[model samples]
Target: MRSIVFASGKGGVGKSTVTLNLGLTLAAAGKRVVVVDADLEMANIGILLGIDATPISLHNVLSGENEMQDAVYAGPNNMRYVPASLSPEKMERLDLDKLPSAIKKLDDSSDFVLIDCPPGLGPSAVAAIKSAKEIVIVSTPEPSALADALKVRALAERHGVKIVGVVLNMVLGDRSEIKKEDFETVMEVPIIGLLPEDVEVRRSAALQVPVIIRAPGTAFSRAMRLLASRLSGEKLAIQETKVKKGLFSSIMEFFGRIFGRK
Candidate 1:
């Protein structure tokens, strides 16, 4: 399987969100994709997918209590995933060295395995970096976030891993944010995708579904699908459609319009 690690130097940059959505999109395209929640301490992928209780998790697999296959769960769009546990106790028992071997075993059955790596250059993140053959860095257009993303890119280079590309998430089309050209110049990497700051993303997370499935027609979702297609070696022409705004989104836009009139 082609192992890809989705990583970020800073948290809340939507690394996990991008990982899950990309996995789902690939699965939708008939690829056997498995997403591993490598963030052992703050394992929120399960929570995000509304899978709060799993008898076997990545923690169990790492601790040698269960095989990696035991933790695999069926997800939306025919995707398979191995979610990490949220327990602090499980965190202490994780064998970081076992990660690469465990990931290797998955190669026999999957077309692609996407690991949702934790933020920063911690042991867990390093383990994920070592396991993955290619890396996809996730970041926002903020200067601080881009600076941290540069650190991650340097780390990947030090380990001699190929960087698939960078995914710029939550773009609001504001002048305050870094431009795509500037971001690419600073990181020395191509921008594979630019996901918009759409309200449907927040709504899908709240509803425990990927935005690609919940709002497939939205600009953000279309970008995700195109990214997946490119990664899977398929050049698909994806067209953006109007976002189906929810009541909360409507309220937010209304308030923004009123505030701007002053």
Candidate 2:
């Protein structure tokens, strides 16, 4: 199995969101994908997948209360995810040393294990990085985010972890944003993907579903699919009919109409 940790140097760069969407996209293509929410403090993959009600989480596994397999939960698009507990009490017992072993156990059954690492180069983030064989850095197209991402790249290099590439998220075509070429030159890594600043991403997050499933036709989803394809080395074709407009879309449309918006 290939273990890849999706990381960022700073928060609000949408690393977790990117990880969830890519995991789902790979799972939808029939790959055996497992996403682990390694962000102990701010664990939100369960919320994003709408599986927050799960009692067993990564905290249980890390605390030695349960096996890793016991915390695995089925997620959307045929993906399996290991969510971290939100309970403050459980977070305290988390043993970072157990993390590498927990991640190792999933290698036999998974084609790709995508770990949603915590932002910044903290202890938890370093543990997550050490557990994975490779890393994918996620950052926005801005100077501050890029600068922080450079630190992450340096961390990855220090550990001798192979960097697959960098993903540029929340890219707006405005002149103020750093160009793709400049980002590559600074990070010393090729750009793997570029996700635009799309409203659908926010709408899907508010609805607690992946944008690819909530609005498959949106630009964000298209770019996400392309990103997944590049990583998996397979063409992940768009399937809009797979996800129909649901109550969330209806409600948003109602509000849009009432507010005289598109």
Query: What is candidate 1's CA lDDT for residue 115?
Result: 98
Cα lDDT listed for each candidate: 0.86, 0.88
Q: Which stretches of candidate 1 lie over 4 Å from their true place?
A: 236-262
Ten-residue stretch with the least lDDT total in model 1: 240-249
Per-residue C-alpha lDDT of model 1 across residues 1-262, encoded as one tens digit per residue: 8999999999999999999988888887778889999998888787666664577999999999999889899987778999998666777777999999999889988999999999999999999998899999999999999999999999999998899899999999899999999999999999999999999999888766668877898898888987888788886444322333442233334334433432
TM-scores vs. true structure, each candidate = 0.89, 0.91
Candidate 2 residue-wise lDDT, 200-258, digit = tens: 88987877678888888789888988999999887865444255455334445534543
> The CA-based lDDT of model 1 is what?
0.86
Query: Could you tell me which residue pairs clash in candidate 1?
Result: none
